[model samples]
Target chain A: MEPQLNLVRLKTMYEKMVLIRKFEERIIELVQEQGRIPGMQILANGQEAVAVGIIESLNAEDVIVSNHRSHGHLLAKGADPKYLMAEIMGKSGGVNKGKSGTLHLAVPEVNALMTSTVVGAGPPLAAGAAFAQQYRDEPNITVVFFGDGAAAEGSVHEAMNLAALWKLPLLFVCENNCWAGAQSYSQHCSIGNIAQRGIAYDMPGEYVDGNDVEKVYDLAVSMTDYCRKGKGPALIEAKTYRMRGHGENDHQHYVDKEELVFWTKKCPIGNLKEKMLKEGLITEDELQVVETVSKAIVDEAVAFADESPFPYAEEALDDVWVK
Target chain B: MAQLSFGQAVNNALDLAMSMDESIFLAGEGIGVSIHYDPNMPSHGLLEKYGPKRVKDTPVSEAAIAGLAVGASCMGLRPVVEIMFLPFITLATDMLVNHAGKLRYLSGGKSTFPLTVRVKAGVNFAAGCQHSHNLEAWLAHSPGLKVVFPSTPEDAKGLLLSAIFDPNPVIVIEEMGLYWGKGEVPEGDYRVPIGKARIAMPGKDCTLVCYGGATVTALEAAAILSKENIFLEIIDLRSLVPLDRDCLLNSVKKTGRLVVLHDATKFGGFGAEIAAIVAEDAFKFLKAPIKRVAAPDIPVPFSPTQEKFYKPSARMVVDAVKSITG
Candidate 1:
């Protein structure tokens, strides 16, 4: 039997994941070419499926709040790539008019409400967003994308408890990528499965192989449906790996060479392509088109950002007050 | 017209603002129950009127409460959250300073985040520095926040209403000592314009500027000085950031002498800012060096005796004015 949104979303998820991977790699190219993008560059290069698959399962009105490495989630949630790319380049056409840069990009039109660099901060904010939707009797849900590093923060636990207690329409999506700024998950936390912490908060806790896009999407669909039905919040721990170091400057000497090899072999994009070919979902020729289209779109985004002008220095004082 | 205490005035303000605006909601730790019915003293009886949905009681999660307020405000709801004490604000500062104050600016003015934070402040409680430290200057120093401190019941009611409606994050610093102090208050829909100072007791000899609990001391000092034939003009600086600069400069220009007072520690206190402004703008008009009467550089002690010493008193204000006037 076909799972809910399984086969139909698979092709789209593959395309979206390719675009996300391409977008993240483009930042690396810019780093080497332009001596970095004028700000702290954190790439979600390997965590592509977790972002693409879960976002693909969400509805248009659903809200998503994310953290520093948020480009993947923003792109997958239908943010305009040109504007987002411009934001990364510190251009006036950026989503926040270049004020937020890559870290705190907020695209309200896509229901991507907030992106904060503060670790573990997004969940509490998302809980509040969920509170608003619930208070308004709205059917939409708010999803917070945070990493395993954020899970160790007390605020995350507080958000979970608060959301569960108030029965808020929130879904906490944890991308457990095993490294929190050079510190391994084992060093930071004793709890192997963050999803199980949902039990302490009295919510459903589920875990899935993050590199498997289909599994992540199916689980996200179920949880979003649960929250939309006013069933309160749930937690999903997508076990994955960070293929590179934490930031643009990190050389990953602190990381294990063998661990990198293992995650690279399990690369979400590669696994998805293999699965699609094995299932006869797309022929080799169709796959090539998807890759070409994704690359061209990313190239266009870079061009748009390159052509976008930087904001004037005086503009910094403009938006401090709403009046 | 009705007589209400400073605490009752806040309740009146919340009741009126919430009724007039459906989008307005209250959230904090035990805001419904009044946090042991103590510092929550302002939001008493609101939970019954608005119910759990609007008048929310939260866990002892300052970050969550602050973040919730920021998050809800972003989504078009007006949340007036109570962060119980001043020092605890450090826990919520990330959400308040980084997100709440910064979000509207980051949005390039495309959105308005209209939320109010009711902060309990002062040193008179003798509850130690943890619960009683004053942080108005810190809030004011942040670029995107509006800070107001009311020393009387009428100003409390009016300022809270105005703060609740303002399009920026307005921090209403309530002096815990003045909560039970009573005064005449307008009944409904009254508003005191923020960033404006009031002349508590006017005179021509010297200008004494103060706010929150210190306003009481300044008024008392003016009375004592007046009896001694030294007429002290007392200006209650209601707000810190937008700071009634013209009223202050004009007052300093009139009296030709200035003294600033607050309960916060002397070094780097908001009083220093006031002193600097007068020193810069109205320097030619000054007849004496600007003086500041403030708490010594120390924490608010828990002992009532040391706490009394830790507080800025009328005697301190009078002594400061005397030194500058002499």
Candidate 2:
């Protein structure tokens, strides 16, 4: 039997996954409507399990730095979907006052840190956050989420080298989502898995089926614990895929139809629900109740976002300096 | 008060600041190690004093070094990082410009990022074009960043302390030529406010404005002009980003003449900003056309003979002042 979390916490995780799916689906509608979210939207529709699993093993203090595709991770870290919705819509009530559209949302209150828009810019920032934790002799670690395309960036290599050399408490989580803005991993990388690149830094790392939350969580527990124990940085390649285009703007004319169908069958939420039911972990009514709760939460989030006001035009000149 | 070299004053400021705030730490390439180590530079003896954790020595990664500062600053630590030289700041500009300089603004004034980038400017040691070019103009041009270049050992200590504690990203340019130059610096906790300028020498005929090691050039020119009974008031702009326009305007209003000088190339140099400020704000006070003394628009040469020609000399400043004050 798979070692499972308590039923309540496991069901909460299921609820969060559904909530993220609904939140993303709502955002797609907002983007389609056009004037609500002015900028480009990058949604993580099929990668909910990876974020939920990693966040399950993390503490409140673990600093998280993410990339452009960060809505799922933000939600997993307990970000209020309402402020996040307001933020993406350029409203004043956002966590960041709408200064960071969807691309750079930083909910510092939850230790979510900043979300960098640049492709490979997050690793170095994570290294620095990790360095600070280690310097303070604190047990808390830093987790940076990057994609496979970032693996090819020299900044990522430099960050890895520094983290290993200094024995910083850092976890390099590479969410290998198959494609980086429409360019497949095969085209961007010379190797099959990015986690193997850790060998050059003399750091231990491996890959896992990111679609399987239990498997990813089992590894995340060990990897984050390894970093928290002051054993230096660790790398993990969460092999996953986004069911949608890189951004809502693109059409997936380049994707293979058969491959998409095969992956869609491995849907994380559906698979987890099937397992839970097979083992009698949850009843169909309980699962349906969770979905209903998630939909209500997303409904409130959208209402809050719609009611929020846009920031003043002159507010742009503020916040550059302190005193 | 204590007499200290410009280099020692920097070391003193860092030492004092670290003693006061445990959050302040140092990280750079060969920080206290032999490669970038010299007993006189700002980071010397820091490793032995703070130990390995606080004074981190890292691999040759400029981007990571700056990114480290940006990350650490957000984590309630005031990280004082080194970019080695002005030219190498290019390697680190992405972190400074994209993250460090913008994160706070992006944070909607809700967060504070306190970090300092210590860089050497105003050519010395014949380190060639890559190592010797003064790139203060590049840093000063980037918004949300404060830039400072100390002309005196006193200002060196005060400005560095202020830069470290300032609740924003600041670039402290330690003029390489003035490292060993001696002046009186306060013992501890002295802070020269950012966005402030100091009048290096008081006079009446002309306002000679300059920064970094060029302050010495301006001073030398002042002495020469004084001998000929043509007094030139000197304005050493300690900070650049906040560009002390009031200081320049008031001095020019009194002197009725202006001469901007620096060791950087004339085109698009920070001196151009000073010239523009005077022309825009203090133009009515001018009795003659404003003059500028700066290096010619060319790469700083590798050869010492060529390097001397590349820098603006004391004679250049004197001539520049005479053109406006004659």
Candidate 3:
């Protein structure tokens, strides 16, 4: 059944998905043109719903700890596109002062922290942030975004156990895009459903249609509300499909071509636009407006990144040690 | 003055800190339980008195425990995390190195992590390789962390209190072997600053420098040598990082001979760092080359017979001191 979502919320969700798509496309284009970014990881394919659904329901004070595939998460959480692009370009005006490249972009103003390219590293950090929130008696929830592959990691289970046992206000969003690099979910994880692992910790867990943006948003909103009300931790497994390869260089030879074609048909953005049109929630003209605005924003970000000066050589040593 | 066990002294330090500042809380595995390892555990009665909110019991996730402590400390709370065993601390090094140690520096000094990580080190009761490890050298090599290994009950109370109040990440290595060992501890409210070494014994012929359980062994060796007319000086390095170079150099200059002792593997151990400092600063004052008495570069054997040979003993310290002063 279709989840009840307001027109305004649906549009906002569409805008966020479009922004993520365009932002990732722009990043891929830039990387193809440029030889390398010292420390960058692109999460371009299958994780838009997790980022949009959770960020839309969070307050400005709420903190997010994202995995390597965190561009969509950061952008949706209000990190400036210009600074984020500059950061990927290794410019001085970038977030983290260019010290943390793309993989480790930390925008404290937006309460977003991205970790290194190590999988399953953000849950512990999210638990820490949640602990901090509870200690300070702040009405904020800490959301951690991880991939399906991270479900197999011992650290993830450990963090889940701690969050549940301590009753910390933590929301764990698993972007189950069905692949961990070249390996499929079946090869990596024994449990068919990753969210079911939450039961071991005695926390609330749910599975959502990741392609359905409204369903994802509704679940995330409800789960976040449950956590914010001091009901402890919850986990959401957004079962989605990656329309493209894992990264820029991967051809995804391991994935069946027919399966790829099937997921492409269920592209999250296309499905959302179709739903909006069928419900008469948004006109074609409104969709066009969002596309134009998102494209313009991506173009401006590219220009800003290209024109921005590279970080000073001395800045390399500056952020190495905080005073 | 109240004389407390080493474990009780550490517990008292936490109680004092929590009483003085409401922002301080203790969190770790089995912390809320009154009878975790022993019937009369040091953390016993704390959960009932302070409530579970302050004395939290976490799952057996060292990484999460360390990360939570780091994050909580960054948000203006002093968190003391206890890892049941020192070997388990390796799981938390990522958070310790990436977040706790580098957060303040990464944020351009906008953040400060006042975290105290407590772990018990040493081979006692045959806990085997996984539990018995003297890994302070690994933490000492890191720039942003403060490493403290207190030997006596007083130093344990003082150093732990100071670590809680200090505006940095401190790793307090409590030797499990010395937990039951007693010493004089001041009654109420005392703190010993980090980076200070104390002269446990004063003599002229040779200087023996050590900390943690090795201090007791060194003192025993010093007493044995004194009966034979060999006056030995013993300096206990209460804190490893920001080491007491002045005390070490002064003692080395006066004694003209030195013997460094530590329970960790001899190669690349913290004692080697002390040897280097003396060699660089007081090389000319030395009448004999500095000697070191430490465990060989191997894991602590499980067998009692082998473990005794693996750990540096009072006889080894005495032998090293006699050889250096001869």
Candidate 4:
């Protein structure tokens, strides 16, 4: 059965995802040409649904903490593409004023906390935000996005235990793209499923088809609602696959060609487009308009980044601490 | 005036701050419980009397505890985080160093993290190396963080209340040895401002600088030295980061000698920083090269004999004073 989602909101979510895909592709091209981008880690291929689905379900007041692969997360959370692009370019006009680079973009207006380059650092920070929200008696929830590989980190385990025990309003979204850098999930994780870790903490856990955008959005919305209602923390492990290398320079030597092909067949964007067309939720012309608009927005953001000035030399000491 | 323990002084300061300013609250692991201290005990009972919302208990995640305190402080909450032990601060260093310390300067002065992290230093009984290390020197190196180590109950109450109200991240290092040590605390609320060192005792032979539990040791050593007609000037360095350079320099100039004491390891301790500051600023007045009497570069041992050797005592301070004043 189809879940009831508002058509306008669904289209907005689709647009956001497409824009993130285009923006990341542009970033990858620039990185390949220049051999450097301020924030090097890019989650271009594997984890769009995890960011788009969860962020789309959040209110502007709710906060988010993103991991190293945070471009899609930041973009989906409604950061200005121009500033984000400028940030990746290390320009003064960027969010974080270029001090954070790509790895640590933070926009306070949207309530997005600073991202961490460490794999499992965001969970504890998110738990802290949850504590703050609970303390203030605000109906805000903290959503943290991590990778399947980060599930092995002691910090993540500690964060989960704390979130559950304190009944903190937090959501742990694991984007299980089946690899951490070059190492496959089987080599790194003893347990086959990352979602099972949630049971140990006594928090509700679920696995979703990450490529199915509608399913991811539905689950995220429900989970966010549950967390807001003070039911405590929950875990949603989105089973996805990386279509690109671990980063811009990676050749993915350990990944099999067949496995790569298998994931490409399950492309999240492609599946969403097909679903929209079959269900008559949107016409081809309307979808074409979204693609065109997203491309233009991405193109404008890239131009803005290229044209933007590098941060002033004195800015290096700025934004390291709040005055 | 009323007699109060170091822990009681801290609790009184927190209660005074919380009552004075509605924004101030306590958050930490086991803060609300009587397990570590006592629920009816000064600080723990304040939470119960105030409410769970004001005196909150957090899960055993120091990073989250510290990070949340930093975030909340940025948003106008004066959060006093009770880190059970000084060694456990390593878990919260990222937030303390990167976020709390740098947040004010990073935002180009747009934000201030008014957070007070209360932790106990010194080896009380046999808690072993991991739990007994005095690591204030590691934190004092960070320019943005304010380090406070109070010796007496009055100083603990005043300095902690001041730290709670200060507009920066302050590390209040309490000594487990002084937790039960009683002193005359002021009847009403008061605050000992950061960046000021107190002259615990006055003399002309040598200037003895110390903080936390070692301040007691230094004063005791000064008394011993007085019996020998060695006039020792004891300076309690209440604040370490914004160190009272003027007081140290003036005292060193008058006495013509200096001896620094701490419970931390000798190398790279806060004593080193103080010694360097004196050498750089007041080297001309030195009778002898400044001496730093501190723990050897070893962990606090569990054995009573070894632990006594690991921590600096009055004898060591007296010997150092004698060497510096020779």
Candidate 5:
């Protein structure tokens, strides 16, 4: 009595998750070996389902303002991994001509407002975008991505308050990854869940198991629809964990080993693969093909990045103003 | 031409811009709420005209308001936001400086932020330390931002129009004290170009350069100096970011003396930048050492007597000019 699933779309989602995992794994290798990426790389190893689920629900015209840990979101939003890799490697061929590097990846062509390195900065930007969309009576919605750490920021509260007050079409997606760097959620947040904060803004808040990509996708679709209907903003707390350290530079001594083992067992990609196989939505061979395609994409991206050239020293002075 | 106060001129400009460009809307504290606040604050009565969607009366969240403006601008809407007091802009510097100012550059010129942030500068009727601040120096120092501090009612109307049309983010600094000052304003379709300075008066002895709240002080000092036959040229630098160095240097070159004036603190103020520009670029043209008439390096005191001493008045400008030209 399982619900019918589109095998083609399920395969696509699986491939994207694979691509994200492989892309992050390659970036870690690059950072370790050649020091290619600028700044610390915050890999979305286990949080791929949250980004893939939410972004899949959005139209190409809808805007997404991402936070520091945004690689998975960028990839899910149709950013070519080649340019992203080149940008991470600080090459001229990158999306921002390597001016932004890892923390500030941007692709305006797909309504991807540049990623903000500052904690809790994206929500206000999202609020602004949503306000514009609503003012113009455009049916587009804006989704702002933040972490458990950003839930405590006053900017987030102010932005949510404005979104509610104005009845803007905005979706606040909080990826509760259990830790803000070495600090655990128990220490950083008083509330057990970030979704509960949405009540303060008078918006519908929901929680989903981030490891279950299907549940996340269903919830994201509902929330995005709710906001787009002019019912004001909505909040979603996807309970998840950063399987890796906060950033590549973090030693991660604060997290208990038992907690890590528990989350690792609830791996999103693995869970999805098991579900699909159980339902006969995808065979092991089909899943292997998806994995192979993802690996090829990441490999091609790395090759393109390695072949890409660095920008000229004088190029730094460019792009500051528009005539 | 019709006579209008500085605040009326600003209201006229907003009304004109909104009439022409439906994309231009107002968002700020006290923008919607009418009655207690007077016409001197341009945002009064706007809510009735434009309704809630166009005239967004926001909560007292400076950061969110600024961020909303910048975000809307990026989406191709011209948002004119108000930061009630200049000092309160500190709460929103992250959005104004980091996001709004750098979005164009960081996005590799793919995005444009056409945001007009209207802030009132200088002391406002003993509004106290928190409210009374003319922090043009802080805004001018930021790259990717255009800072305009208009003194006259005419300039207020024209410059605000220009700031709205500007593709980048602009901080329009209005002087609270100049709100009621009346002057002839062009009836319609006016724009005072940014990055330009106006020569208020021509003279041969020394040049008095100032802008914002201090422009009135320079004009007042010009009148006194005229009576004394000092013949001090007065330069009102309407735009601070571009600095109007050519206009400033040319005036100094003609008069052979320079006296920069501002309401900001003397140390590390905008006057220092103007002074350095003259010292470096127009040093050969100077007849005497460059002097700056500015507020002392201290917070605006609450007591009127202490504030009077803290603020740089027309007397200070006159004294600085006498010391330099004597």
Candidate 6:
């Protein structure tokens, strides 16, 4: 049963997750080295599996709209690392030519559409893209990656209701990292599980352990298939943890030390590495190669960003109109 | 040429544009109804002709639907969205002002949000307060938006076509007061170029710069002032941004006197920008200080008498010209 799960695909997923983890880790160092406080540095340290596993099931033709914590989803959805790294460093060679820094990133080639700064904003956009695809008679699906905090927004509920009513090929993925800024899900939301809200919209609501990459990957595959076949919109709530604060400036004194320790132990990358080794799906040497390759790629990306030139001041006036 | 009301002209423009381009779709509330609600509304027979797929009647989620239009436009579709009333556009500010207007700039010119929003503004049918706020000034303030307020039925048809085809986001501000106003519109294809002002009634003494509902007042004032040998030049500023500054400065440069007019309140109204622009650049050519004739700083009242006073009328424009040209 383990061997039938496709070792090559699983191996790729593991490597992608490693790249996301290492990419984030390196960005923090870069921000620190710059001697400036990172303004809105949101790292998806523990939420790697949710982005990687779900994105693994999507093709380049499909669309994905992400929230502020979007680097993981961008990388996992096949966004070029060099451009993304350059973008984060505010270089002209960035994906948006340095116009959008950490919060907003759009790579259209892979159908990785806009990443919004506003919470709950991406779902409506995802539904819009899905509407176009459906209208054009295309088989593409749209996935919106938002957090538990965003699910509490009226915009998200409105988007969900509209998507369901329109029967769009849309999937709403809620990465319940528990803490929205300093507030916890318990305090912010009246409902226990965010997925339960999907029931009101007459859609299937599924929850999975976000720490387990295999479970998320399997569920995403089935869900994407269901949506592709035009079964209407669906929702998936990944019970994940926020390993770090909301932004780089946050001290996270409001977070429990025990909760941090618990999530650290259940790191998605560590869990996958252990599962693969015990199942004899991958060798110890193979795992080391994944780390080495990921580090080298990240190193190249950082160097590219470092050497890239900043755009001219006059260039700001350009791209405002499409004439 | 056929005589069409402003509403019929708007309907004809949508039908013509949609027929030409399959990518152009209509999304909004109250657009697909059978009854003629607001003279020449966008819906009428559109739903029946184009079906639900093209003429999308969305739920009252302006933010989501507006975002949907922006999202769809970014991915290579032209969406002509309607916010029903101008006041409801506040609910969609996130999508309209933030995303639609900023996406192209944020993408460093790689992406374009070719989304057109139709907003019915002003008071005429006693749709007081929430339904009758003149807010084109709010939209014109955004950099990326091409805000066009067409006065006549012909201009409405031409401007709506241009707005639909523009690669950038455009706010087509339709005056509720002018929906039933009839005018001669040319047959077949024609476009009233966006960002260009039209000389509604040209004169040499003073320039009356106005748009939307205020155009009617300005024209009436021009006729009344003509009887007194004032001979005011009436310039209907069709577009707000990419403003026909050339036409305005040329007119101001010729007349040496200017009066900015609008249905919006006098305080921080769009007229202020016109006044400031003329004062800054064309001050040397001015014989008198720039004057503004606009609605008072208050909401559109319910009573017909109060509503009459709340909106700027032809009498106010004449009074303003008298004060400025004195």
Best candidate per TM-score, number?
A: 6
lDDT of 5 by residue, B186-240 (tens): 9997999999999988899998888888888888898998888899888999999
Every candidate's lDDT: 0.89, 0.89, 0.82, 0.82, 0.89, 0.88
Residue lDDT tens for model 2, A260-295: 998898888889899999999999999889888888
TM-score of each: 0.97, 0.97, 0.90, 0.92, 0.97, 0.98
| Residue A22 displacement (Å), model 3 | 2.4
Query: lDDT per residue, candidate 4, A55-122, as tens digits?
Result: 88899888888877888888888888998888778877777666667766667666776566667777
Full-model lDDT, candidate 2? 0.89
After superposing candidate 1 on the true structure, give the runs of residues whose Cα lies further than 4 Å from its correct spot. A1-6, B35-40
lDDT of 3 by residue, B263-293 (tens): 8889999889999999999999999988989
C-alpha DockQ of every model: 0.71, 0.75, 0.34, 0.32, 0.77, 0.78
Best by DockQ: 6
CA deviation > 4 Å runs, candidate 3? A1-5, A113-117, A135-137, A243-246, A277-280, A283-285, A299-323, B36-41, B97-99, B102-111, B187-189, B202-207, B227-233, B245-257, B277-287
TM-score of chain A of each: 0.97, 0.97, 0.95, 0.95, 0.97, 0.97
lDDT tens digits, residue span A174-261, model 3: 8899988888888988988888888899999999998887788889889999999888999999999866667766767788999988
Worst 10 contiguous positions by lDDT, candidate 2 chain B? B31-40
* Candidate 4 deviant stretches above 4 angstroms: A1-5, A278-280, A319-323, B36-42, B71-76, B102-112, B142-144, B187-189
DockQ of 1: 0.71
lDDT of 4 by residue, B259-311 (tens): 99888888888888889988998999988988989889988889888987888
- Stretches of candidate 6 off by over 4 Å are A1-5, A35-38, B34-39
